[model samples]
Target: MWLFLSALVLLAAARSLDWQAWLADKSRQHLCFGAAIALVPLWMLQAGIRDGLEVHFLGLTTLALMLGWRLSQLMALLSLLLVTWFGIEPWHEFGANLLLGGILPISASYFVFLLSYSYLYRHLFVYIFVAGFFNAALTMAVKTLAFAGYVTWSGQYPWQVVVDDYLSILPLLLFPEALLNGMAITLLVVFRPQWVRTFYDRDYLINK
Candidate 1:
């Protein structure tokens, strides 16, 4: 499962990520590097009982909003590697950890962003509230549930313990997660709009 998932990530990156565009821009290079570096500390401060069921504030919703899903995946991979290198996460469980913590939230965030961009009103408040705040909360919920499901399915930890310890605190964490991501996105959209790739001035701010 590990090898297959790792390989699958590689394939997805190869196919989805625009290598030439990302490589040619020095700004993009620096931005991605900085984002990856920033994520390391957030990922380090985690709580877990089982081997691979660690809980951490994933900043991927903000990242996906900033860099778009394709670039966010690459950044998440870099951050995961850094976290593993710091000995916070076990190297043996790399793929499983990446899947649960990295891919799931980033993809979910981007999916929500697309939905808001496509179907909903293209107002700045909508982008900030729906795509940023609400999306962050939902992503947190999905990621928490995914972690609980993984531990239960793999038998790495007891289901009851997961429910009592991990799932129990999920509601408390959601607002903070939303606030964190929503605030970051709001600042970027207001001051450094170019930094957030998913946000467009014309689309969200032109008429209003």
Candidate 2:
């Protein structure tokens, strides 16, 4: 399927990115991360083109802020593309669902992880739990606002349509996404914390 092909292409691209070298150079990684974060809202804008020009600035910005731009960008694109290609809905609906449901919540959770682990608390488990909760809440809130705003502005969709969209999609994606982000952040902290610039280590944990 197209989704599988996209995944293959993404994996290939990632493999070819010279990550070993990129990882060694902080400046290059920072630039790549910045560019990646900048692309998410643009991708969302493209998905929302049929609707009005309302920006769904959920925790994606937070994720970018917390995850050092590069990883956030990479994850956002990966989640968006994956959901679109493999989801049950039609392509258009899939893209919308991805932006609203999968991308937003996961990104929000990533943001929460970044903020809490870096600034507030360094305890890994507590950070993961809080991130999951915030991701779920923000994903729901953004979807509600987006649906209501679309209906108010365009007057084209029925209430049933809105309900159906959420009912059909959001429930399916929430938990798996939270788990993925949680596990990913936890592993990064444990094994490769320096690669994740959003996390700060004072005493050269990598060498020790």
Candidate 3:
């Protein structure tokens, strides 16, 4: 199952790559490298009861909001490779970890941004609150539940133990996730708005 899922994730990532676009813009290439470099340390600062089931401040929501999901995945892959190389994470579980902890949350974050962009009021605070804060909190919640379910289904841990040890920490996780990502987006919007790909002054700041 792990091998199969890993293969599928690799295939999806390959198909998702915008090679021409990435090659055309050198700055974005640097951005990807810089973001990945930052993420490696962030992911290292994780805590958990068991070996494979660690919880960390996932900066994936901000990554998705900044670079779009495609580049976010690429950046995550780069970070995960470094993590694995450093022996913090086993290479054998790389695909499963990336699929669950990286791509899933990143995609969820992007989906929330899309919903906000389409239906919500186009205000700066709305963008910061919904796409930045709310999205990070909600995505982490979903990822928490999904990870619990995956562990239980894989027979690595029973449901009760998973709930008690892993799921129980979720509430504590949400606020920090929200605050970190929210503050990040806020600072970027104020100082380096161009760094955030999903943010547009015309959309959020022009009319209001």
Candidate 4:
């Protein structure tokens, strides 16, 4: 299932990506390099807050905003593979990690982006709040629930303990997740808006 989803992501990227546009921009290589290279260390720097629950900052909302969902999904798959390759994560857990850790948060981030785009006014603040901070917090919440659900369902962790231990510290993660993604988006929107695919000057800045 993981391999199949990765393959589907490849296909989606091929169909959605502007191949010519990307090929024309040599600078995008640097951005890709920065994201891909930096994320390994960030992803690996995890804290085992509980027996089976590990906490890591998922900086994927920024990645999705920068690369767009298709490419971002592809990046997510690649990131997991790279982490597994380096032995940061065991090989057996790759599928579950890719689905729960990679696909879940990335997809949730994009979903938040879409909802904001559809319902809210195309303002800079709205984008930052909805697509950046809110998205990150919401994604983290969903991811936490998902991981908790999986552990409970698999009988790896008892429901009562998972609720008390694993779920206890969840609220503490939200603000930091929001800050990480919010600050990154704010910086990009302020300094290098062109790099963020979801940002547009005409939509976000024209009125201001």
Best by TM-score: 1
Runs of candidate 1 exceeding 4 Å displacement: 48-53
**Least accurate 10 contiguous residues by lDDT in model 3:** 1-10
Candidate 3 segments whose C-alpha is farther than 4 A from its true place: 2-17
Which has the higher lDDT value, candidate number 1 or candidate number 2?
Answer: 1
Model 4, 1-208: lDDT tens digits are: 7657646656776788877877788888667656766678878887865645888888888998998887787777777788889888878767768778877788889988999988999999999998899999999898889889988988888898888878888999899999999999999999989789889899888967
Between candidates 2 and 4, the TM-score winner: 4
Q: Which segments of model 4 are wrong by more than 4 Å?
A: 2-6
| Global lDDT of model 2 | 0.49
Screening candidate 2 with a backbone cut-off below 3 angstroms (N, C-alpha, C), the clashing residue pairs are: 33-69, 33-70
- lDDT comparing candidate 4 with the true structure: 0.83
Q: Estimate each model's TM-score.
A: 0.95, 0.45, 0.93, 0.90
Query: Per-residue error at 152 for model 1, in Å?
Result: 0.8
lDDT of the candidates, in the order given: 0.87, 0.49, 0.88, 0.83
Looking at model 4, residue 13 earns an lDDT score of: 69
Q: Which lDDT value does model 4 have at 61?
A: 89
Sum up the clashes in candidate 1. Answer: 0
lDDT of 1 by residue, 5-89 (tens): 8568767876987788878999989998899899999989987655565678888899999888778887888999999999998
Error of 4 at 89 (Å): 1.3
Model 4: ten consecutive residues of lowest lDDT: 1-10
When summed lDDT is taken over every stretch of 10 residues in candidate 1, the lowest stretch is 47-56
